[model samples]
Target: MKLKPVRFIFFCCFPLSVLIFLSAVTKKKPVKEALNEPGDGILLIKNTNGPTLGYSNKSGIKILSIENLYFKDLNKNGKLDKYEDWRLPVDERAKDLSSKLSTQQIAGLMLYSAHQAIPVLTGPFGGGTYNGQPFSAGEALASDVTDQQKDFLLKDNLRHVLLTSVQSPEIAARWNNNMQALVEGQGFGIPANNSSDPRHSTNGGVEYTAGAGGKI
Candidate 1:
């Protein structure tokens, strides 16, 4: 068995200082362990343009594995394909991002995140100014989004959106605020869905695991 090298670009307002810390504390889980259970699970992932690899069609919707996103072809089909530069070319990859980012401010970050680019507004520990002060990474993202920010994100074209667990509220707030500012500058808006808030929950996306049957 061989391991494929994966190149990922992270975009955030602040420097990726905590990346090492986060990586050290969090072990990357395998795909099977994340989605092997019996139930309907939904998550946004990096989908390349090629044959559907390990994912299968559930009724009409597609259920994807977190591990399969590492390369163009996880199923070993000779043809390698992907939606490269998923973010730079805004029109090509805005729909999916829009689906997950409902609040306009949060959607802004999703657009930049979709392109693997981080905003320039994050702080020392992923803090976005909240309550007139810097908050933790999770706190920044969980704050009540502003309507002014929402109107700016939806104007652009997006493909898919990715949802993850809210480990730190301050980090989340900073990530969201940074995105909102960018989107506002770009003259777009995101339609926020109040019912499902990724900032408050973690059940939307699939988790990874490690093992022989893992999704690697």
Candidate 2:
């Protein structure tokens, strides 16, 4: 049987619904507000190991503070579920999440988006359009979301994306943040996993072939 994400309804005077979020990792328990940028989609908490955890505010994801530790609420059910707890085995968490997804979501999970270029273009390789026009037809950033990207993401429900082009590190970072925020407000708040072909170049522990004059 297909499973559905748990959603809640608030009977406030204006009928308000709350989104939940959780920090992927956190340091000591939060005694006071260390970071506060409430309306922005995601919140960042400092990790003891030096990396910050980001969670969306609109997606109903929040950081649960325990005896000084922070946690992520991946399913956004107002509490930290098994899948949200990083301390557990990843396989266990994945199984829990897998059981909560609907059939459509599972189909979406199976789909893989084609090669995409950040700030899509009108070129020969990995070219795309803005709205219906080329990226340069008007002033569009390399990080601007193209029409095809939106269609595949929402209509096709494809979460996996392969990025082929990036203008700079800064542009790529901004694009990633924007993409996460956009999808965070969507159906089940599952984040996209953007990837690219691995470019591996290693010459370590190689032997020289004197006959071919090559390193292997």
Candidate 3:
């Protein structure tokens, strides 16, 4: 059947118009303005449809805004790096980060640090000194980073830290923040991967149950 010219053109354009309308309606909205929260030495960037990014202002890191979303300028190059973009896959991000590291930096990552204790214990095993004085001398706060720790973090580029005895949860949190700020300003801005040995002593009498979570 042959249709009139005007009616045929209208019918052909109607389907295309519907598709365009649907595309416009389904398109994602751009992110809203970041809600900035500045506390202690950290700045938190909150977005409606994006990841929240927290960075230490003292660390010399800056924020990179792309497509109304925020990202940390970890290398401080004033641009978004692949590793710094949270949208990328984990393996892709790891590859991008590994490519940026030098041989020495890779070696440093391989090196696992000795057991460290928060508040710098006086015993020989996990003990550390602040400045030249032991932590027991009351010369420094329990959260203060030891001179030895600073040396390893900066000079040796050590990213892995083994935390042994944390004096208190509060003290441990403060110490972690301090350490993170220290390395966030350095090359590639890699934060410390702090770990601890099994701190919870299990009861011999209790039987293990699958998917039963227990407090530490």
Candidate 4:
């Protein structure tokens, strides 16, 4: 006779669903505002040093935590707030966006941000002339051109040749667009393509066309 022992059966239930709901509620925090008036009394984040792209303020500037910021719909997708919603490192963000944007869009954005002129072409001869000034190592970061290409331009003084022949036609078109913007003064300088000198009132005055197409 074989005797078999009965196995005990048990049902175990966990409150995992409740835990997850509670965790989300606990983690949610409010977005922060970028600027504050004295009456607002928002938490004052200590002034952190930043890149001096513009004229520096003698008095150090204060920052606020992200939690104190205003929430606005950015994408219009109904999502609340975004990393771009705050005033932070837009340059890095632009680079990030560039990775996702079309090449033309990236080029456009580069020109839009360039306060100084950006060269579309530099060559011994062309519609535009090469200044022959070597591209700075750091300046490459602010431009659409690559280090190798910039190096080639400096070595040969044939930047326009490269722009017309080497880079993809699509990119070249965008680069041209940026140049046009600079020439028109929409992207750089006041008077938008006119000379600052009161003596010359002509459009795209001497200064505007000085280095244009790489003239000496």
lDDT of 2 by residue, 76-155 (tens): 66777777777789899889888888888889889888777676635565677877888878767766777888788877
For TM-score, candidate 2 versus 3, the one ahead is 3
Can you tell me which runs of candidate 1 are displaced by over 4 Å? 1-32, 35-81, 84-142, 156-216
What TM-score does candidate 1 get on C-alpha atoms? 0.21
Q: How far out, in Å, is residue 147 in model 3?
A: 0.9
Q: Write the per-residue lDDT of candidate 3 for residues 100-200, one digit (tens) a residue.
A: 99999999989877777787666566677889888888989988989889988999989899776677777888888889999999999999988755534
**What are the candidates' C-alpha RMSDs?**
23.9, 15.5, 8.9, 18.6
lDDT of 2 at 65: 72
Q: What residue pairs clash in candidate 3, if any at all?
A: none
Q: How do all the candidates rank in terms of lDDT, highest first?
A: 3, 2, 1, 4
The model with the greatest lDDT is: 3
For 36-138, candidate 4 gives per-residue lDDT tens digits of 2332121222223322111112112222223333322222334432233335566765554445545543343333211123333343321222333344423
Clashes of 3: 0
Each model's C-alpha lDDT?
Answer: 0.33, 0.65, 0.78, 0.32
C-alpha positional error of residue 138 in candidate 2 after TM-score superposition, expressed in Å: 3.2
Q: Residue 35 deviation, candidate 2, in Å?
A: 2.7
Q: Point out where model 4 deviates above 4 Å.
A: 1-21, 32-96, 112-216
